[model samples]
Target chain A: MKTNVKVLDCTIRDGGLVNNWDFDVDFVRDLYDSLNAAGVDYMEIGYKNSPKLVDTEGVGPWRFCEDDFIREVIPEKKNTKLSAIVDIGRVEVDDILPCEESSIDLIRVACYLKDIDKAIDLVEAFNKLGYETSINIMAVSNSLGLGLNEALKKVNESPVDMAYIVDSYGSLYNKDIQYLIETFKKYAPNKKLGIHTHNNLQMAFSNTIFSYEQGVEFLDTSIFGMGRGAGNCPTELILGYLNSTKYDVRPILRVIENRLLPLREKLEWGYNTAYAITGLFNEHPRSAIAIRKSNAKNNFLGFYDKLSSVETHEDIK
Target chain B: MKTNVKVLDCTIRDGGLVNNWDFDVDFVRDLYDSLNAAGVDYMEIGYKNSPKLVDTEGVGPWRFCEDDFIREVIPEKKNTKLSAIVDIGRVEVDDILPCEESSIDLIRVACYLKDIDKAIDLVEAFNKLGYETSINIMAVSNSLGLGLNEALKKVNESPVDMAYIVDSYGSLYNKDIQYLIETFKKYAPNKKLGIHTHNNLQMAFSNTIFSYEQGVEFLDTSIFGMGRGAGNCPTELILGYLNSTKYDVRPILRVIENRLLPLREKLEWGYNTAYAITGLFNEHPRSAIAIRKSNAKNNFLGFYDKLSSVETHEDIK
Candidate 1:
């Protein structure tokens, strides 16, 4: 409680990456209640992408996160703040209502460094609408030295309250995290720092702790590390580390037990060699994900050869 | 290839903690062949505990590691150095033949700080027999201030070739690893350093890298991090970091692919909340293992309470 650290339980939102955002409404609602009762600071329910901009069919209610649906699920929001992420160009400006008109309190915009200008515009739009906003720069492992400085400069000038150092590839080590955060501070010095880590190298929890130790405020986590590929750091580990009376780990654990544990069979979303290989090369995990779906799911060497045979930017590093 | 660091793959040895060392002979043989082909510096095939001192029933050949059995498996020993861990008081000294008479290249004694005297005695015995020796100080998280100084002193005076800072509970952070390695250097300055880490807080890879960065030469890893509780650092991750021609990552990947991946369903060994809770407290993972095997396996809160209810030295911290 005394600690300035804030836990954002993005179990539903980030986990959607692994399951195509197909969670049921009941699960999302219960997750909201559980996180609130757990004394977690925030709950990122899901993406706020416009259905018109992307296919909504077969996707869960959490994906669109219409104001009416969120209100219907949790008419009375409790201690936990409600939030959703919007991708650049994925959500129409009209899709975001004034914060006073909706239950959502925070609007997070996740985008690549190439679209930093657009992400900043969205952050400005949401900020003017009475909502706190954050900008997440994805795949920094690959984006470093490639318009990153300019993007960070642009993000620094924006009205974004928080700037997230997203480890989309899960390739960063301690030294790399230090270097990345220092660079982020050089430009976005005034903005609160957030850490969004993937567990490809099993460094997610440690990386999050490293972030907090370096004065980051927001920590993103998923239940049992349920997310795309290697998944995010587990909320349980984060809560356990914080060990604040203000944060109740029991509720987080209960949600994992009652709702998330059973999803393992279909999701297959924890740290594996495929993700580890991609992480090692500092490359995107799209190929690893493809390999996971193919007959060579467990064939690590085949995957390695397949990855090596391909000519790409990641191999140069 | 020229880093002077050594890789010790302990897939069969440490992995025995999960499946009661119930590995088939064919699989061990194939794994031995694979590690040799990979140019891995060392291959720890199994435990060298005396069968008479403990129960051998239901365990496999790896547990006892009979000299005749080892010779039969590796009829013509290749480039990989063969090693085995001997628990103090568990293994009969008469059982160990001279290094030249046996195929084993090294004899490692793993013990708690309280048993350091006994471990040193074993190390001396192994060294006298002309085999390189290392003393693995198990569960240093709980044993840090308790008898550690005395243990390190006795180990330093002993004829041990290497002194290992083992993180049995997988609770150590990079800073803690730094502290422990420095402590070992203080007492055992002349002895070569080694690191054996467990992955409870998901810091095994980072901790291992920290050890290497700190100049610890002997690094212990498993095929797929296949060990007790949260498992050891994966050999694949270690190889990925080394990225040298001396280490062929493909074979490690192949063993994991063709052999180890299939054992995952039967072995629920990896990072999980139960183990994470135990690790956070820097206590033994026996309670977590018990919780894992019980009905409340997925009940994180229940397991948390179960761990909290236990009043021991760990709670004081």
Candidate 2:
């Protein structure tokens, strides 16, 4: 039986946040081949944001994926369709060629709630260009209540094919994912729901699966969960859960072993107490990241004082 | 309203598998004080097994926890009560002091289902001594069908206060956990269920939460998830999730940062590709542990091929 869900490998896009998209060309190409052989539905190669727009000087080609560079990376796109994330103000409209003319099959718009209008505009443009478009509502945990409802309503009416529940802060719990999905369903019934999770609380894989059980079709993942602070749901893990005959666990495992595992020693991401604390506070991981980079990485009391106060919190719901 | 759950820390006992209970006296004592301040319900101090019976050589004081060692560790008993695990064949009856006379309040019997009769014998002795007793069914994932039901039937009639769903292999999923609990409940409805999970698949914290939501009470955790192989569900993450005013996450965080974080550099544990592969195959982690010890720690594909055959598996349920 055909499954209702699709796994999107976001290794280059999300992992870029850690290393300024400095991955070697050979590594990225091998990743493309691996994910394709592994039967992943979508491979988000990198960002479409123009380097000039973001003023990325020392950043690599993956940061601002030119059409030419993308073609060189994946000379012949196989089973895994290539995609790119475009920040609202960071990409020039002319840079995004029509889907038929470009190698990218999908163009995802990532934006804050305040920047929804720009995201919608970009989504419309990408849609008119005959590309599958998704609008990722970044940092959904911080913007709850009416602000989120209205944003969902806008995406529901927009031509975007998919709307994602992006937990950028990595603070959401299983119950939080359920509540958010219910809220999203109420306002965005017309949109195919997607999920992007982080491993701050070590809930990424489970939270993503919860979304799948809740009927969210598009799930974002990374090989070995190699992404920004705390990382994303691992491709190998979710692939095991999806367990489709078409998806081979070996290729995903191969890529994780040969390419990403050693990167972890230098990069030092995933479930750490610092990230766990930021996830608990529902704050940006900047402070935690700062602590990780400092010599006082083990000074949990200092970091705790920065986030939590002397007043004991009695609320547990 | 008060929550019907207890947090049981197995830092000394579970983590002992990694460092052979070679923790400094000051570190163990500090962990005890920290857990008490954190409002943890119980802290499993160490093993109650006799050194003479086990013929332990290099094993530290934790392996043969004497009543005197307990008194010295917690001179002033606080909020958190102390407990110890006793292996069925490794402890002599005469070595156990009466619970009221000793510093330990609980004596948990860790044994295979085959040893249920012997486990009951230990439980009965500990019970008559006025101590709470628990029968930990270690490696529940491996013995699923009839073997488990028969074991549960035995424990239900025993005087044990709690029966744990122990995933000793660091394998098992949310669905597996749910199914096993259902199977466990059917045969042992009278016993309060507890959960002990490992992080081989990075599902420890989430799986434990699933158990809590499904009515399991006691949770086994260690600071920084420091334990055998891939480790256990982190205490701080669960403490954050429980979110009770009574529980201070900071104290747990402080102990983890000050004591355990540095230990991690010397001893590697937590989810990795090799462990993830072992978790997938439902095999023992000895092979993965060997790979981790060897120079090819990052050789995930090599390990995957070792456990799994080239024949494509259509057998994921």
Candidate 3:
């Protein structure tokens, strides 16, 4: 299983959202080295979105990761390849450079249903720059049936190397994942499929396993579940379960011990009561997130009632 | 979903393993009242196994829950019923009193695969005594295939009202659970099925969902996951997900705030990496337990290699 499926570590990148991307260069360097040693196929360094595009004044380091910064952090690349994500509207076309000139091996574009055209433009540009590319359809739980069909058709026409099912709201169940996988395979049979899940419902790991069993090639994970709102599936969970001799989990453990553990003490994230409730209700985690941040008293009954009464909209707001 | 399925709160019983059952009578009384008000179906007060059997001298109060002690703890009977578990070999037949005279509503007999005969004897006794009886096969992961077949045969012949698929090792995935549920249903077609899952693999919630989908009627949970080796499934997760208007999660949340939260700060039991690894490997969590107890330096590579080499055994040992 380890030999067949590739693990992409996204702790420094996705986890940055939880901590406002306050990580230092040394932490990023250590994480890079550790992930390389752990046999991780890719490390998502950070978002490649242009700072100017997303209100840079209040944004953090992870909000706008530069190629120079990535180069400085990882002076010597090892077995692990580097990947950076660019949100459709968040990043400008000028930010992407060729893989030969930069350390990045893959440039992933994330977009909502309406932004598939914009995302594909980036994917094509990144492909022309001599970089492997992926288009991650975000909030896919809310994707219109025809929207996904259109996206898959566009992906088939583009030079993108991989297509990803992004559970941005962490709302997918195993059946939902199976459906998405089957749909993606039907439309883009030649393209590799990747999974990026959040643990809002505590189904991230299971959903990933379901996707893997269905033949997904790329799995995204984070150390200690350190991503936004309950975090991404823990990388260690996947590594431990794969049970492969070639996959050494020590480097991943070392990264957790050296970097993520301290970060956990500072930032509170993971499966909390609020997140669990939101996941169960099949609702967006904004209410849970709000409760956690404001220290507002949790009214489980009220929250549950609200979730049950209202059908969860594709758009959180 | 919540309206039909019964929830058994085992916070005081399973949580005692972590805290030594040193809870004061006041807390117990409060919990009983709170659980009743919250509309929980059953409240597992403590283990009825004899202290003489387990060498439990000087252990927590919950470790040695005598009938007299329990009688003193819950002074009044309410809407919620009381349940107590007795291990097959750990309990003496002479110790159990009929449910008619005592406040205890349910007498659960817990046994290993080899001890099902003893468990059956006790369940029969409890049934004769007019107590609702359940046979919980413990450390089920360790049961040999033949042993389970024999045990299921006994369950089919026995008069027990419920039979539980206990994931004692916290090692079962969804497919494993589905297999167990299907097998149990095949053998004991007339009996009610219960599920008790631990969060070691972080699949407890998902597995419970799987069981519920398969028509399991009883689900066991501890508030805030305060049980042995990664703890039980979080009750809040279930209540929130079931999304039934009849079951208000406020009472459960109240129990957490009033009892489990403070208890959590003092006693440790939860989803940690080491435990998650053990669950992922489908192995006993002894090494992970030792690591937590001693705070020993972890050797991930060595541990992974050792664990991987071992044949996949379902037993907790």
Candidate 4:
């Protein structure tokens, strides 16, 4: 029903955080073909982080989405475009090629509030290279009383094609989302809005739809909600909800059944109480992820107590 | 922050539909104690259906919810009250004891849109015997163009203390929730409202919270979302979100870790592609449930195709 809405499948990029970019080439090829057949607008192949800047010894090819690697995985570009994410200081502009010479069609810059200037600089560079660009502000839930207005104004003044509201901590509720969208619109009125969500409390899908209703044009989703900690909004859910003739959900469902479901045997993601606790406090999920790897994985009460004690200590300080 | 909102735990009642009421007495006792310690306002022990009306050979004691059975399980009543749900034709007035003579504090009648009259009769009977009463209209999404206005008006004129919006098929979105709340307010202005959701699309927690924001007084939840099919909103989520000193989430988290986690080995519930497909079509989950039981459990594409064929055939008709 919505013609302007664009769905970006970030299964390989966002889901990389879960498996350390260990996706097989066959799986990647299947996903690429399925997403194209499903009529998804864009597929974020992976990150474009420079290998020289970060440790990529054990990671897969997705950690550094070289243009040659992308072409090898997906030799032909279909209706779905290609995208890659880059964090500030993790990317080298020299490694990126002009849009006509590369498989990547869009380059998104992910950053925190403190790195807005650098993010805008990279987004401006990517835009100049003839690729669509977006600036994703991570952890906007913790941006309370921070200089979000100023950051949005800075982004608004840039050449960014889209500005994303990323719920990195997965702590936002409907009211917070409403407030953030209003703030974004007020300061960044010149830019299009996008929504990226995490499923720490099973609100990823709902909040994404709520954002769409409030005029967010771009939505970020992944296969089976495979991401760090609690995962992201599921691509199948968004495709099924869209129910447009342009999009076919059957292909998406097939890929999930064939590829993503088997990976669940070794990898763990989705909603858990430990992750929910961290999200409740608007904290990073690194602690929860660590505890899950430890023997106290199921000790949610202990996790809650630890968080409560930290809050108390902070208050005392 | 929300002092007037009441939380109801329906793990045994709604969850009974999944496992056929086969909960152990020890498990039930543990859940009861945990919910009470967690400061839940009410706990729906199970159904009060008459054995003469429905076949109950293999079912557990929860299907009956006899006063003696509840008393045996919970000898002492704490701050949390007890409630039971019954259907229109499956209950007999003589089977119910007076509030002062029984452990039950509330009696809720569940019905479809066409059975509003029968539901109100039961509510009136229960109210006359000094028990809190409510009327839950099931599958209201399918009640489109039905006489919902007439049904709500009839319930508004009854002795029912609460009116519920039950998304029986898990088919509602935010716009539908907003519209339903406004319609319920317009028709049943005097009755306090409650929400009971299904998580087929992973919207139960968000929808419940949205309803609360719109001033719905009573909230229905289950431990780890252990209901039929995709289950209800998780009780732990609401407790964490409420964050009032009156409610403690540690006990709920413990119950989930100890009791509900083990139940996952035998029972398959939660958001799956098959369930999401049925929810998107606004159809009952019987087909999805059946497919989940068959060899085609993971064949989401086949399931989607089957549903599509049926829809096409119906359109021809």
Candidate 5:
């Protein structure tokens, strides 16, 4: 069902976390044009994180998506609107300008369960500045039970235009996505909903589709799944699957052919053994990353032997 | 959850279909040793289809999968059992004789809904010849209503060791997979269940896992998703996700680093727009493939515009 649901391409922003945001201006401009041609609803160019707050030297544009740099990249606006994310702690309030004055149409605020209040503060500031605002609760997998209920209450009361169900750990299944969407809908009936998923579990595409079916208005995607640790669902996948003559797959293909593919050659991301295993265990991927870096003689049989021999214990949290 | 389920690596058999079975002897040997080390229950070396029947003058080894060639490749049997597939009409009974004397341990029969009788006939012959046998009914997506029930009856009467829930069109979702597993269990409770899925819909891994949760014992995978259309679920994904330390991912990774990645540059198989769309539409990906080849002038805004205008439809089946 290709309704009013919008797909926001976040390859540079979220994906930058994987490669330290090493994208060039020409690549970003081409991605913007391509995504616009591909019927993408919005292009999340990068995070508006303060470079001074985080180490930014040699980092990618996504790590520091400055307003002036973004405006310079896309000299003229097209069909797709531009968006940028700001973490509760990483961005300064003064950095956000009115939508009429800046190229960004949407400003998203991301936070953990305990920081929704701080996130709401940013959302309010952005909203007052006349920009579309969303509050994305990261690491929702760890915030099940009562924490979720309280968060939902805050979301309901917030001035945000949209609320996001962020599967930051990439640990959620389809049922979990369904539960989260239904829960959010029940609690915040008046606010629109969005989805931001990671492919650590290979469920990002399905989870996003499930959310769409449940009436989510926005979907977050990347070109070639270029987000952190296993990546985000590929934007081209959504465009192709939706089969809407409105969205062009060529833009995404161009982005892959030009930007993401080269990035892939330089930076190893996407589905790897360690990430897949961590997904299978429903645990954080730190263990898998450690194993990969250790270069422990590639002995799969040995690994399997160790896993099976371990006492069947509680599932990894 | 990682109990008695068995993994069968069919990279040569299934991926051959995508690449015209052009794999070399060395790659096959490496895969065999790696799978053995990883404790994969079975490795499908290739198909047993007759060269004469399929017109294989320049066809690849993976396409033909001759018993003699396979015997020469692996040389010795180890922890992993060797298996070969035979399509109903494409294979001659005489072509299988050497398998009985070779390292082959299983012979699988693949057929469409209309060819169950032919598949059963082959299964019976393979069983009598002292080889593990299975009947894989292809295009189960089109097997609606009585078609499924009728096929189940034939499978119940067959001598096959396992009956497969083949999502040939890559159309089945998780719930659909669960239903098919339940249906097979109801009709052929005495037989084990297997899964053969394509990634056209990106559900191959999730659907395979759903089958496992439903107590289906056999799982099929290919390396780097190197089968037809979007290809099969990546073998490494299955191995890593199964949470079986016994299924070491290194061997699979080694296979990719040494063989599949290079092959990927020459061949154009793997997850793509056409396959993903086909999966989303629950239709064959032939049209999407045609679109990709035609290089039609892309109209991105038009595509999205159409989708946005349409009333939402719930036809993700």
Candidate 6:
């Protein structure tokens, strides 16, 4: 129903955080083909971070996303463009080739509010290489007030193609999303807006739809909501919501049945009590993820009490 | 955060559809105590339908919700009130006792658009018996246009304390919810509004919150979303969103840890592709439910194609 909206499947990119970019080439190829058939605009394969800057002993090929490896996995690029994310310090300009020489189509820079300048610098380099670029401000819920306004102003002055309002904490409700959208549009009038949400309170799909209604151009989703902590919005849900003839839901359902469902048996990523607690407090999911890996994973009440105790301790200051 | 909002726990009433009301007495007692400690306003025990009218084979105690059994389960009343739902033709006038004599505080009549008159008749009878009454229009996504307006107008003239916008198909998005709330308000100005949603599209909790923002008062939830098919909104998520001192989420978490989590091992519920497909088509979950019971449960693509095939066949007519 929407003409300008572009759905980007970030299953490999965001889901990498949970399984450490361990997806095989066959699965990634299947996903690429399915996403292309489903008429999705972009497929964010994984991070494009430099291997020289960080250790990657056990990590999969996607963590660095070399052009040659990508060509080997996806020899034929379809309508779905390829994208890879780059954290501010982990990536270098020399690692990225010119867009005409590489299989990747877009390069996205993910950063916090404090690193907006750094993000813009990378976006500028990626733009110079003739690659589509975006600046994803992670954990925007914590970077509100004047700090966010200042960051948006900096991004507005950059050559980035788009700016993302990322709910990294998965803490925002509809009102918070609306307020952020308004603030981003006001401060960064030159940049297009995107929404990246986590399903901590089961608001990911709904909030993405709400954001679309409020004029966000790019919507980030993962197959079966596969990501870190509570996960991102499910790609199938968003595709179904689009309800346009341009996109097909059957391909997504096919991939889920053939690929993601089996992966679900070996990995766990979705809503639970621990993630919801962190989202409620507008905090990162590290503590919740830590507890989930421990023997006390099912101890939700104890987790709630511990969070509350920390809040009590903070109030004493 | 909201003073007029009333939280109602329908874990038993809605969840009974999944396991045929086979919950043990201790589980019900524990849930009652937990809901009370959680400061929930109302707890819908179960249906008050007459056993003589419908086949009660294999059904549990909740199908009938006998006053003596209710008193036995919950001997002392707490701050949380008790409620029961009844279908239009399944219940008899003589089956319900006076509110003062019975433990139930509210009697909700669930019916379709054609049965609104019958529902109002039941509500009037319950109101005359000194019990609070509500008219829950089932599958309201199918009852739009003039029928809904007429039903709400008829309900406006009744003694029913509240009227519910029930998304029985779980088909509605946020925009539909907002429009439905506006229409319900325009047609039933004298009655209070309630929201009951299913999680087929994973919009139950988010839609409930959106409905609250639109001035809907009564909020329906289930512990861990323990209803039939895709389930209802999780009680803990809404409680966490309210962030009010009047409610405590720890008790709900404790019950989920001890009871609901164990129950989840035996009963299959919550969001899945089959249910989401049914929701996308605005159809009843019967086909998806039947398929989930069949050997082809994991064949999501087949289910999606079957639904699509039906739509294409219907188009021929």
Candidate 3 structure quality by residue, lDDT tens digits, B63-127 = 55676777788766878999988876788777777777777899888787877888888988889
Estimate, for each residue in A205-249, the C-alpha lDDT of model 5 and write its tens digit.
878877887789899999888887778888877776566778877
| Regions more than 4 Å wrong, model 1 | A313-317, B313-317
User: Which pairs clash (backbone N, Cα, C closer than 3 Å) in model 3?
Assistant: B20-B60, B21-B62, B141-B314, B141-B315, B142-B314, B142-B315
Give the alpha-carbon lDDT of every model. 0.87, 0.87, 0.81, 0.90, 0.78, 0.92
Q: For all candidates, what are the clash counts?
A: 0, 0, 6, 0, 17, 0
TM-score of chain A of 1: 0.96
lDDT of 6 by residue, A1-317 (tens): 76899998999999999999999999999999999999999999999999988788999989999999999999989899999999878997987899999999999999988888889889889999999999999988888899999999998999998999999989999899999999999999998999999999899998899999999999999999999999999999998998889999889999898999899899889988889988998878888999999999989999888888784322200
User: Quick one: ranking by TM-score, best first?
Assistant: 6, 4, 1, 2, 3, 5
Error of 4 at B234 (Å): 0.5
Model 4 clash count equals 0
User: How far does residue B245 in candidate 2 sit from its true spot (Å)?
Assistant: 1.6
- Per-residue lDDT tens digits of candidate 4, residues A1-317? 66799999999998899989999999999999999999999999999999999998899989999988889889988889999999999999988899999999999999988889999999888999999999999988877554999999999999999999999989899788889999999999999999999999889999998898889999999988988999999998998888889898888889888998899878999998889998888888888999999999988888888988884322200
Least accurate stretch of 10 residues (summed lDDT) in model 2 chain B?
B308-317
> Per-residue CA lDDT of candidate 3, range A64-156, in tens?
777787777788888999988988677888866777989989989988878889988888888999999999988888884977987898898
Cα error, residue A113 of model 6, in Å, equals 0.6
How displaced is residue A255 in candidate 5, in Å?
Answer: 5.1
- The sequence of per-residue lDDT tens digits that candidate 1 reaches over residues B166-252 is 899898888899889988999889889999999899989889988998899999999889999999998888888888888888888
How does each model score on TM-score?
A: 0.96, 0.95, 0.91, 0.97, 0.79, 0.98
Selected candidate, larger DockQ, 2 vs 5: 2
User: Cα miss at B238, model 5 (Å)?
Assistant: 2.0
Q: For residue B46, what is the lDDT in candidate 6?
A: 97
Worst 10 residues of 3 chain A by lDDT: A295-304
lDDT (Cα, tens digit) per residue for candidate 2, span B1-317: 13888999998898997888898899999999899899999999889899888868888889888999879877889889999999988899876888878989999999877788999999999999889999998877767888889989999998899998999877788889999899878999999999999998889999999999999999999888888888999999888999988788888888877788778879887777788888887866777889998998877878888777735533221
What level of docking quality does candidate 1 show? high
Model 4 agreement with the true structure over B1-317: per-residue lDDT tens digits? 67789999999999999899999999999999999999999999999999989898899989889998899999999999999999888998987899999999999999988889999999999998999999998998876554998888888999999999999889898778888889899899999999999999999999999999899989999999989888899999999898899999999988888999888778988777888988987778888889999999989988888888783322200
Could you tell me how far off, in angstroms, the CA of residue A214 lies in candidate 6 after the best superposition? 0.7
For model 6, the stretches where C-alpha displacement exceeds 4 angstroms are A311-317, B311-317
Model 6: per-residue lDDT, tens digit, B1-317? 76899999999999999999999999999999999999999999999999989899999999889999999999999999999999978998997899999999999999989988999999899999999999999888888899999989999999999999999989998889988999999999999999999999999999999998888999999999999899999999999988899999999999999999999999899998899999998888878888999999979989988887784322200
Measured by lDDT, the strongest candidate is 6
- What is model 6's DockQ versus the real complex? 0.90
What is the per-residue lDDT of model 1 for residues A89-109, given as tens digits with 9 covering 90 to 100? Answer: 789998678999999999999
